[model samples]
Target: MTPLLRNIVANYTSQLYVILIGLAVVPQYIKYMGIEAYGVIGFFAMLQSWMSLLDLGLSPTLGREASKLKAGVTRAGVLKLFLRFLETLFSFTALVVVALSWILGPWIASSWLKLESLSPSDVALCVVLVACIISLRLLSGIYRGGLLGMERQVVANVIAVIAATLKSLAVLPLLIWVTHSILAFFLFQLVGAIVEIVLMRIAFVKALPSVATEKFQWNLLREPLRFGVGLAFLSGVWIVISQSDKLILSHILSMQNFGEFMLATSVAWGAYSLISPLQQAVLPRLVVFFEQNQHDKFVLLYRQTTMLMAAILAGVAGTMAAYPEHVLFAWTGNLTVAARAADILRWYVSGSGFMALAGMAYVLQHARGDVRMHIRGNLLNVFILIPSTIALTLKFGAIGAAITWAVTNLFFLIFWTRIVHKKFLPEIANSWLTRDISPALLVGALLCVAAHQLNWPVSSRLLSFAGLAVLVVATTGFLLFIQAETRRIMSFFLRGIVKILCTKNV
Candidate 1:
């Protein structure tokens, strides 16, 4: 397989594995900790996103810096640059984590998070534990971006698979055998975070050996810092866009209801997972292409990747929209939770699909180092999204939060995309819609409508899961392979697979 496609597949494999592990663990976690405790865990999930605001765009900037090496920087030069970058990032992230944990942790545990079963002390301890986990993660995140810049995704994903397994699957035993507390759960994650950092260090050394021997210098960071400021704000804006609804819903709904919402959010994110790997795989290459002033190649890669990504995302989103209740019940084994979240999941997942498309546009802008469009778009969301979320939640409750999320994304899909295309690549403005989006939407909507109308009996959970799985495959395959361009790419991909198998056989 081509290196880009290979990286995408490997990354997707790792992500899918993590999703499955989390799916398996959720029921056990809810059973052990109960929904309120699990909701606290969900709140921690939101806190992780909040904590990422401290990243200051350092990690992605690191990736962008490393990708510049493709322009022919020496190993020593690259290592010097990287070490300087990491030093600044690690030091700043560490201090922020300490400050945030010390100041905000107590407030969040005591006042912010709405708790029911867990005591204030217990909740406080969990907050502190999550702080530590996020701190370690913040420290280690640069290597992940570094690996992406190096195009070392296969090795990166191997390390990620190991880390994902330890953080997720290992938690079940920790909860069952060790302690049935959220504090204990997060403590285990802290340990996993440390180990992940260590493995990332090893992977970095292996992937870029000279980096291990180089001395650090602060000078290399000056350029990246200037670039990173915009990126950092962009990251924060997105985190706000993503987490604002959940934050509002947390206040409006009870802890148990919020937990149900969180569950559905998790599933929506899993669908979005289909887009992320492809985005990461394309980004370094896009940067290199832009740097080389190859606009045609850049546009081609952008369009092709968007088509493939949108098609895949459409299928995943369609399935969730079509079978939210069945899928949730099958995954969580709580019909009440499933029932509560089913409607929200449909709206949220549909929005996620649109968000995935917008993500591609955002990535293109980032690759070009043109953050103006994205910044403006996010600013618009801040003004519109936050107020709308608050009003909707106050008036209509949790479902309103979901609707607001969907509407905000749909708005971005039309508005931000037009601005991005107009500013960057006006030529494909009409073609992108005609070729990539409209057809996929038509197919996805039809699949959702048809699948929902089917009289599939939910007599057995396994049967329901199997039926939904078929629908997912059918939807994804129909959209993904329907277009002539995508079909051609698939044939090439298949040929690559065949070539690999033949070589192995020899």
Candidate 2:
């Protein structure tokens, strides 16, 4: 297989493994740790998202630069110098992250979070550990971006699979056999973070082309600094748009309720997770295409990947949104939790699907080395979303916040995406909406409605899950079959299989 296709497959495999393992283990975490403790874990996750703001857009910049290096637009020595500069910058930032975490942990545990069963002291310690783990992982992103930029995705994904397995699965034994304490969970994560960084650093250094006398150059920062600053602003706004609801709800809802909300959000986030592998694998190639002035090829790749992503996301999101109670119960095996989270899950999954589709615009912009449109769009999103989220969460609790989430993303998908296409690639904008995105979404939505109407007899959790899985698969297959390119590929594969069968009979 070609490197790009291979990278895409590897990334999808690695990401799917992480998602499946995480899905499998989360209910067990709630069962063993209790919902209140799980709330703390959720808090840690939010903090991680917030901490990404500290990256200052350097990680993505590194990835882009690495891609440039591979395309012969950038020299290996300069790439090495750039990596050194980021590494050094991150070292100081890591110290600051640890210090801030220590300073804020006490306040958050005492005042910010409404804790019930867990001790404030233990929670504070876990918060500190969370900081350490995030800082290490933040450092690791420098290397991870470099590897991805170089298109060494197989190596990167293998490391990711190993790290994800340890982080998600290994923690189970530790929590069950060693201790159920939240502190123990964070400690295990801290160790995994350390190991991940070490592996990433070694791999990145090996991937770097051999260059003698690599020296840090201060002037080299000027070019990426402009791009990185725009991205940093974009990142900050994105965090606010995405996390403000969760942040507001954490304070407004009870700890147990917040945990349930988080449970729903996690499942909803699978929509984005499903699309992210394609994004990562596509970005470098997009950059290369743009650099080579292959505009037709670039648009073709963008439309094709966007279609595939939309199809899969529609299938997953429609099924989950349509039958959230069954989805939650099948996954968690808790009727009470399922009932509590079902409405929230439905709305959040819909929002996540739209957000993932809207994200394609950002990828297109990023590949072209301009994101001012994205920045402006997100700035507007932040101003509107933050106040609305607070008002909704306070007025209607989790369900209200969930509704706002869905509406905001849909608005961006419709309006902002159109604006982006008008400016960048106006030729295909209407066709993109009509042909690329609409078909899969309409079909998937109809299938969801039909399935719900059928009222399949899912008498048990296993049956509910199996039935949902089949529906999703069928919807995905139908969507794919409707697409001309995918249909042709599927036909070729089927004909090959038929020929093999006939030969065997003869």
What do the candidate models score in CA lDDT, each in turn? 0.81, 0.87
Q: Model 1, 185: alpha-carbon shift in Å? A: 0.9
Q: Any idea what lDDT model 2 has?
A: 0.87
Every model's TM-score: 0.95, 0.96
Tens-place lDDT digits, model 2, residues 302-346: 988888888788788988888898898998899888888999999
Off by over 4 Å in 2: 488-506
The C-alpha RMSD of each candidate to the native structure, in angstroms, is: 2.1, 2.6
Which numbered prediction scores highest in lDDT against the true structure? 2
Q: For residues 452-505, write the lDDT of model 1, one tens digit per residue.
A: 678765566788788888877887778767788788988888899899999999
